[model samples]
Target: MRNTSDISISVVVSCTAQTAALLPWTLKAVMAQTSPSHDIIVVENSAVPELPSMPAREARRLRLLHLPGAARPALRNAGLAAAQGVLVAFCDSGDLWKPSYLAIMREMWRVEPRLLLAYGDAVPLQGDTWGTERGFANAPTGFWDGQRSLGPLLSVFDQPPMPRLLEFQPFLPSGLVAQRGFLERVGGWDTACTLLPGHDFATALRLARHALFGIMQRAMVGVRPEADGPAHAQAVNMGEARILERALARDETLWSQAQVIRAAIVRRRQAALAIAFARGDLAAVQEIAALLPQQERSSPTLLKLGLAALPAPLRRAGSAALFGLGASRTSLRWPGN
Candidate 1:
């Protein structure tokens, strides 16, 4: 394994047909990294024939992999295999990284050479909605404990973290940096987790089970909300649920911790359904609602369903009222209704 002195980072920016427009910005951020020696691999998982040309510096550092119709997780796995750097980092198209992101994470790895992963908070570029990155910043730290650092607010979750310590996913792929060797040892991203809802979280959780990790409280990355952010939320909701269910099944001891997370996911779904109903998007409401298991539906979901059944005009007005008046009183749900 290479030492931090010989630090060379391989940043994997995964792009898709829908995310093509954001690729330039993502690559630009990579060019601005404070670290001196690093390369980038863009795994384009789309049927698009060609990618936009990159700037000279980024072009020099980049190796384009055209998978032409590949799953997200598979794209990541491909990037993982192709990466040659001692340390590896990942971010999606459209997300912007702070200039110091790589520098700080590298410092953390320098401090603890055995670290399997280092991740931090991200600021939401879109509107601050329920369960958004902005909200996560305000939420209390349950699994991760904060630490003081010269650059950012840092935290360290010891290797083999306390059971269920990863119940709440506090990080994203954009915010994480990991050692290549450690990742290889644990096996790369689960290709089966073709859906993200929790692929990033599940991978991190599984790594946390065996390796040391770090976290930064301050936002190190700025994640842009998708064009159809609400629609993406539904996918994420399903993704998280599936990941948790599989995890729980594998280790029943995590049931207590998993239950808290399970309830949270359910509530998020209910909140999303409410938002959809309020926005007068009956179709979206129905679609999101159908995704939830019948047994998991809660009172809030029932209320949202009733609200959605109202006339479109009334539903829109009620949604605005619920979101506006209930801002402080009601627990705001996920983004985009």
Candidate 2:
């Protein structure tokens, strides 16, 4: 068992100057930690102006690594290497961790020293919410939904229903804290998904090989899902997947997981399309849906088609009835209604 006393944790948060506004909430949450990380590395990826003028003394122990060429995986890898702690947690620019976020992770790790990768329920920030109404909402529309289409991709030993992955689009980047050794074993965040789309899914698929993980029933982090520049991110994410597949070319064992990975990717792509359609952006819905592999596009398109086929009166009727249904629902169980 790794001695907790020797454990130092690193929380990686990155932002360009353009997004610096989002990092403060994250920094605030980290500073609020009752169980302080041994080291907190905030990788400033912004080119124009770096992190805000906030004093370093605001947080107990903090270090800022300024990387102008930073991408998500590069920042994560740098933070991981720079991390003096045995455990590492991630909080992105627009996210906020719950008070006990780090503490709960510390306790869980302390209890099971062998545990490698662990993640839990994430409270979605509407900006980032991609699917699921209970996930995060903006007025009449849900920016993100908890529904996951590819549920089977999650590989924890006591895994959730594979189907649930379909509704909630399992494996969020914001709600995870993992051991450095385990991360090293799995090769850190695959820069492949570093873009926008499959990074989380690819990370989940690759990281699962390292352990039988646990799911914290309570939400500990707020994840904003709005991806303003998804095209570029998706392109990068796909490139990373290809890179990862190449890296694993010789390993049949890990390659075995590719099918699950593929399924998860398909679900992820579909979920985004679902949300795009709901947003009433027919062009975006068409563009993204067409990007899906032909065979894979069928179900989601059919689902969209089915939804589009709905009589306007009936759709409006359901919406009217649901107006009374409220905005959010909480469940650690499968999120589908």
Candidate 3:
């Protein structure tokens, strides 16, 4: 293997006002890496560009790019443009990296010079507590089983099927590291996809088309939980549907599975509609319902439509009683509902 010292890495962190408080912990993790990065860039996208103070020694290699009020994709793109390393890694404001994270990634790149994109598993952090499940556990069954092992801890997806990626996206930006040249070749982040929940997933889909992808089986990153609520769920569903639509439009390979993709899109919209209905957002409910296929005469579709037609107050009450206005409001119970 090539010398690890020869590999240069830049870490890009995306932050907003809401997540700025956790930035110190994130910076601490980055600074503590066994294989230190060439530089650390934090892109602050908020109304006011501000960051917590750091010691002179720690701040020397750290730079702040203040893109006030910019969207996530734009923030990341800005960081990518300013990065001056051979490999670029991304982290969210509240996420963390284990001390060995960069060392492991550098070793993997040294061993496999063809790797364009690689990601590892991240353990979810809820407040100060860590979750037992790693991020890869969320991947669909048998998804990783087909990968060819580069080593005991490394697996490469040799020409992964596009359908599988579309079906269940398992990539997270926080866990990803990519070659700077390959990232630029793929056009970096899609600035057009601003404010979308799964823009990173969408970008990964684009990269997966031609890049050599790899997975580190070990969990080397920590992911903090995002806001939880029905509105958040609704936005996620809508964003996912949009991503599927864009993929179907551009990729002819997915044309064969148009029906499957369409069905998936409808399922997402239906979930969004359900959330809208539960939250008493009648306008959103009707708007989302209109996008669903007219041929969907399923009982759930009929029931949702019928409920949507009733008086606003009655509809809200009925939705709460049926779906239980708690955690279940995020998704419908019945399949295809």
Predicted model with the maximum lDDT: 3
Off by over 4 Å in 2: 1-6, 47-60, 126-168, 228-251, 254-337
Winner on lDDT between 2 and 3 is: 3
Tell me, by TM-score, which candidate is best. 3
Per residue, candidate 2 scores C-alpha lDDT tens digits across 123-227 of: 556654433433222112331224222122222343323323323345567777887877877788777545544455556656655444655545666777544
What's the residue-level lDDT of 268 in candidate 2? 50
Better of 1 and 3 by TM-score: 3
- Alpha-carbon error at 310 in model 2, in Å? 20
Across 1-337, the per-residue lDDT of candidate 3 in tens digits comes to: 6788998999999987777889989899999998999999999876336557878887888888988788767888889989999999999888888899999999888888788889888777877676667767677677677777778789787774455665566667788899999899889987766667656667766777764688898988888756556677687778878988988898798788899888878877877887876676767877887888888645665676777788878987766666554236464320011
RMSD of each: 5.3, 9.0, 3.7
What is the per-residue lDDT of model 1 for residues 203-308, given as tens digits with 9 covering 90 to 100?
Answer: 7667667646677666768876554454455556556666766777787767778667566656556655654554446666667777677887766666666666
**Window of ten residues with lowest summed lDDT in model 2:** 328-337
Alpha carbon RMSD to native, model 2: 9.0
* lDDT of all predictions: 0.66, 0.58, 0.78
Error of 3 at 190 (Å): 1.3
